[model samples]
Target: MIAAGEVIERPASVVKELVENALDAGATEISVEIRGGGVEQIRVADNGYGIPHDEVELAFQRFATSKLSDASDLDAIPTLGFRGEALPSIASVARLSVVTRHADDDSGTRLEITEGRIVDRQRQGASPGTAMTVRQLFRNVPARRKFLRTTATETSHIQNMVTRYALAYPEVRFALDTGNSSLLTPGSGSLREAIAAIHGLNVAENMLDISVVDERSGQSTVGGVISQPALSRANRGYMSFFVNRRWVQSRMLGYALEQAYHGFLKERRYPLAVVNITIDYDQVDVNVHPSKTEVRFRSGDRVFSAIQQAVRQTLTAHSPVPEIRRAGATHPAYSPASRQPSRYFWPIEPFQPSPAPNAERTGELIPNEQDAASPTSNGDGGFTHKETLPVLRVLGQVQSTYIAAEGPDGMYLIDQHAAHERVLFEQIKADAATSAPQSQSLLEPLTIELNPRQQELAHAHQHLFSSLGLLIEPFGGDVYILRGVPSILVEVDPVRAFIDMLDEMAQGGDVESWSDRAAYSLACHAAIRAGKVLTHGEMTALTRQLEQCQQPHTCPHGRPTIIHLSGSLLEREFGRR
Candidate 1:
């Protein structure tokens, strides 16, 4: 009794095993409808090779299967539901009923089972297909029934499983209805079309195809689509990996993908991907897990390498992130480092900046050295701006840090320090990538005094520092002499930049990805420290440089760079619209 209990864990598990059986029976189109999160009823209808009326009763017997005829078949199992445990297992727990007709049969057969025993069997007229309905799952075992989650959560599991099958078999049409919601997958045999139908056209359009077609590598083939770095999710929920059309969650594969997107995404952010790895049945062992979601591969490391290299190549071929950036990438209207702190606050505009009356051009608010106190706009924190949108105009500085700006669509509050950090991070990465880390010979050598441990660390990583364009050498004792700095930080304090990089390394990050890690550290410390006023030119320059960055949405540390207040939202708040 508990054996069947292990097979059908929930409504989703029932749906999964049933669907795999339908596919194994050569189904072309399948429809899955679940009610009460599949606890109440699960109806799966498939147009496939159905069982004969005489054998319909026998199929409910445990270990009775047509998949494996001999012992040797165990070494090369290809069918999904070969163990024949699904039907009997499912029958043992729920009120199970099946109606199926073979293509050659004159009539269909319906069988009902309770507690793994065949309770009823009858002949009926039906189309050439199979339809199974499972009701009152875990009814006999009230303990299991009590463990089921809410309908909504269980519905997600079923939906997620159906989506996996839909992706695995693009030629098969799949429809899923959870309560009133429905998902229809196109049976046109195009993975992109399937994705578009399920995830939406925008996500599909943004995906880049990874094809290992013709180019053979080992005993498997790999092909799928991965999202551009610009499209990312906070979790790995969007990533899917398939081995021989079986959707399985493998952490080794997931880690490989994450490693492939090493510097492309912010820490903790994951790229969306649907990777399908096709291999022969002989090379993969599918009997490892009760759920059949975990499998053992003959050459696991090779598979990992293949996935990593394939994804890396695709990203390199077409990436939206910019490659090279230099210092002073901002616009010319502002200079933050050189601006002087003003004594008085400038008067700000009203809560909402009304458009200029009858003016042809939207008069810009260029951040200048004037006592520019602007009106308190509560609307600033609500809007999220895209990089392609119109750039905002700098309206001057506040608290010697934030840059006030106005855009055609809304007003923006820009964090000057964060903005500079993003700018420098990009510049450093670009410079480092080309192995041309721009260095500026300091007029007077900056000596950095470090503790004994830090001094030892500095000496150990002296070659690394030289590679990063930090021309540093021990000046004896617990002191290091810095003669040059990366051009991006040349104007900033060299000693501060060096100390910050060391501090970041101390905090724990990949020193091998020293370019990116060091860049993050360098950008953070060397950025315009808050409380430092910006000149009009400085502010303008920063804004312009920011616009040129690939990912201007957030700083290197994942903090937002700009906050916007849409004009319409402002009007709505003010009762104008």
Candidate 2:
């Protein structure tokens, strides 16, 4: 009973399992009808190979799955919801009714199950397919039903799941009805069409195509559509990833995607993408979760690297700048695509909703090898901007924090702290690669107290400490005296910064990641802070130095240093043509 509860937790889970059964049965068209946020009723009808009357009872039995044969089949199971637990589990908590007929059969069989027991069974005349209606979900388990969110939120989740599946399978037609809202997806077998129907025309046109193949495994292919960095969300909820056409949420893949846009996007900003990954069925394990939303890959590192490289290359090839959209523009009231040079963009078409708008690695989580070897250029580091930053005419400072400058195409507002941080981070990285970093001897030694663990950590990584230009002497049990500090970091709190870096490394991280943490900490502390006044030459010099660095777009912590307000946007805001 508990296991069944886990498989059919909410109305969405029930909908997911029933839909998967339909897909597994080779359904070309599927329709989902939900009422009361799917709590009162959920009807899933699929025009697929219907169930045979003789096997109708067995279908509701726990562990009864038609996809798997033996234990070995578990390694490479392709079908979703193979637990066979979905049916009986769902029937146990809801009022369920199913009517199915095979093409070869003369009639269909109707089975009414209330609270898991067969209340009635009879032969009925019906077309070839299966329609399962579940009502009063969680009726027997009031606790589970009570935990469900309001009708609107639960319905949103249901809509998103259906759209995700629609995007995953463009060839399969899907219809979702939630009374007031009807979503119909054209099963015309075009991914672009499906995306437009589900996400809207703006999103479809804004996305870039991605295709990458691993030479190590000729069978592996990663391809799909990725939204421009500009079209980002505050969360990862909008992103969709799939393995063998089954949508799965994976940290490894999500990290790869985020890391690919390290500098292009600010912290907390997540890009929207519909990424499809295809690999040998034997390489991935989909049985990790009962909901089948998580999966395990044999070579997670390889997959990670493949995805990161593909996204990095695509972004590098084209910019994500949006075209100037006016107030009278279509439904979105804005445009997502731009006329960038040589960009692989899908042409936008007028969007129309049908009956059902079906809308919708790698290794050690490391950066590219070339990025580590390259001494200059943030492009090598997988940052979006590659070429040198454009020169700007200084227009003085704002609120004693932001440096306002005029560029050829747009006006630029630079965050003093972030700009300086990026400048220092690149310089630090370059110095670390060349030789020992420069240090300044303090006239008055600074002392800092630490816990026993921190002291031990400080002592353990003394070599790395010296490499970053910190001359420390152990004072006592939990005290350390800093006699010298990195030259650029002297103005900041050197002792506290050094301790924080040690704490970060002690927390647990790989050597490569530890290096990033060290660099980020040093740059963060050393960089000029906001509210600092600067002369015209100082601001101009800062801007020029920023241009010379590799990733001038953002600081080490992924904060944008500059925001360009286009002249056209200003004109539009001012009501000028």
Top-scoring candidate (lDDT): 2
lDDT of 2 by residue, 1-577 (tens): 1143368878999899999999999999999999999999999999999999999988988788787877788777788667788999999999999999988899999999999899999999999999999999999999989999999999998998899999998999999999879899999888889999988887887778888976777554889888765577889998899999999999889988887886667778899888989988899988777788999999999888889888878775543323334567653222223312121121211111110111000001111223222333243432233332444667999999999986555667888888878777777766567666677789999999988877876777777667767788899877789998877765578777887877766654444466666777787777777888887756765665565556666677767677667678888789996
TM accuracy, model 1: 0.68
The CA-based lDDT of model 1 is what?
0.74
Residue 187 error for model 1, in Å? 1.8
Predicted structure 2: lDDT: 0.76
Pick out the ten consecutive residues of candidate 2 with the lowest summed lDDT: 354-363
lDDT of each: 0.74, 0.76
How many Å off is the CA of 475 in candidate 1?
8.5
Off by over 4 Å in 1: 1-5, 53-58, 69-77, 217-220, 228-232, 259-270, 280-283, 298-302, 305-462, 471-484, 503-512, 523-577
